[model samples]
Target: MTQRRRGDLLVIGGSEKKDSDEERAILRQAARKALEEDGGRIVVLTVASMEPEPLAEIYQKAFGRLGVRQMEVLDIRNREQAYEPANVEKLAGASVLFFTGGDQLRITSQMGGSPLLERIFALHEEGAAIVGTSAGAAAMSETMLIGGPTNRSCLSTLAMAPGLGLLKGVIVDSHFTERGRFARLMGAVAQNPHNLGIGIDEDTAVLVSENDEELTVLGSGAVYVIDGRGIRFTSLSERHPERILTVHDARVHVLGRGDRYNLKERRPIVPSLERV
Candidate 1:
C-alpha cells in the first residue's frame, strides 16, 4: 500500500440551521467525507479562545456520531493543563485535529510558534489531518484578519491583521456567503494579489494540501476563490485607503463538489485523487 499521504488541511464555515432533518444530515455527511479521506480518527483542540461550551459539545457529538473511533476536544485554555504531558500524547496520535471558532488573534497568539503548535505542524507534516472553522480557519493563514465585524458595519475600512501563516499563499475568510465576507477577503486580496483568497461559506469547507496539486470542496455552501495575478486594480492605486476600493479585474471561481480547485494555478484546482 502507498504509505498514506496526509498533512491535508480543511477549513470550514458554519452549518445551516433548519427545521428539516436533512440539513444536519448533509452537513454531517460532508464532515465525515472530509475526515475519512485522510484518516478516520480525530482529536479536536479548542484553542481559539471562544465561547467553548456549546461549540465543543456540538463538535464532540458530530465527530462521535460520524463513527470515528476517537474524537475529543483538547481545552488548552486552562493554564495548568496547557502544557500537560498527557494532553500532548493525545494530540500526537490524532488523525484529524480541529480548532474551534472564537478569536483568531488569541488562537494564534496562544498556540502559534509553541511546542504544541510545533507538534500539530509536525503531525500535519507526517500526513495527519487538520481542520478548523470560522475564526479557527481564519487564523491559519499567513495574513489573518484579527478584528472585524466587517467593512459593511464599520464606517472607515475593514481591519486586517497578521495570521499564523500555517498555510502560506492561501488566505482564508470563513462565514463567507452568509455574512458577506467577500469584500473583506477582497481587501486582503488587494494587499497580496499574488496570493489566493479562499472565502469559505457557511456550512462549507475548502481542502488543500502541499503541491500545487489538488484542492477539493466539501459541505453545503460555496467557496469563493479570488485569483489576483495578471489582473489590474485601479482602486488599490488610490491614496485614500478608505471606501470604494475595487480589484475590478481579477477572476473569481466558485466551486462545489466534483469541481477542481488548483492552488498553484490559482483557479479551479483539479483533484489528484479519486473520490472515495
Candidate 2:
C-alpha cells in the first residue's frame, strides 16, 4: 500500500492582495494552517528573490496582521548560505513555510541538495503547510517549466528543468490567464502526457490537501486543469519546434472558488448551487 503524503500546500498564482483592507482570503488560510499547533510559527523563505528583504517585509506585515506572532524571514542567497546551521535551525519550529515568488531556478539551485531542503521535507512530513506564490508555485512540481512562449505552443519554445518536487506528477504555471499562458502550459502537457498541468490565474490558488488526492480552488480567479492523459497524438516528436503543436483529445477543466478536483481520478467536482 502507498503511504499517504503529508502536508497541505497553498499554491498561489501571483499578485495575491497583501493589504489589510483588501480581501486576503488565500493568505488567511495560510495563517490558519500556520497557527494549527500550540507553538505555531510561520517562516517566510525569500530565497527565490534577488531582493529578498522587500518580499520578506511584505509577508512579515501581512502575517503579522493575521496574528502570526512567531514568524521569521529566511533569506538564503547561495548554496553556502542554504547550508548554514542557523538557516537550517530557522525551520525547526515552523508550522507553515511560505516561499516568495521570483525565479523558480533560484529556489532549486540554491537549496536542492542542502540540509535546508532536507529539513523542509521532514517538516512537510510532519504536516506543515507549504505555501508558494508565482515562481515559488512553479517550483513545487517535479518538472518545472522554466521558460517558453506564452502566446504559442511549440517544442522549441518550451524549456523545462528539475524543480523542488514538493508535488509529484503535476506541473504548475502561475499568472495563468493574466499572462495568457494557456498555450505554453498545453505545450508542457503535450510533452509529458502523464503529468497534470495546472494553470492558475492571478489572485487565485489551489489548496492541495495533506493526502495529495484533492485540490480545492480558492480566491477570485479560476484554476485550469489540463488533462493530457486522454491525449491520443502530439507533434512533439517532430523536428520542427517552430511549427504549431498538434495535440489530440486534451481535456480541460476550469475550476472556480469552492470547486474541488480529484487528482487520482483526474476529474473535477463542481459544487452544486442552491435556488435563491
lDDT of 1 by residue, 16-77 (tens): 33234455543354355346655556677777756677777877776566555566678777
Tens digits of per-residue lDDT for model 2 on 1-276? 967457899999999988854688999888786666788999999989998988899899998898888998999899999889989998997889999999999999999999999999999987888999999999999999989876654553488899999888999999999988998899999888999999999989999994888999999999999999999998875578668888999999998988999998888975767611
List candidate 1 stretches off by more than 4 Å.
1-4, 16-40, 78-84, 148-157, 209-212, 237-239, 269-276
Q: lDDT value for candidate 1? A: 0.70
**Candidate 1, clashing residue pairs?**
6-127, 7-127, 14-203, 144-163, 260-268, 260-269, 261-268, 261-269, 262-268, 262-269
> Lowest lDDT 10-mer window, candidate 2?
149-158
**Position 14, candidate 2: lDDT:** 91
lDDT of 2 at 202: 91
Rate residue 1 of model 2 by lDDT: 100
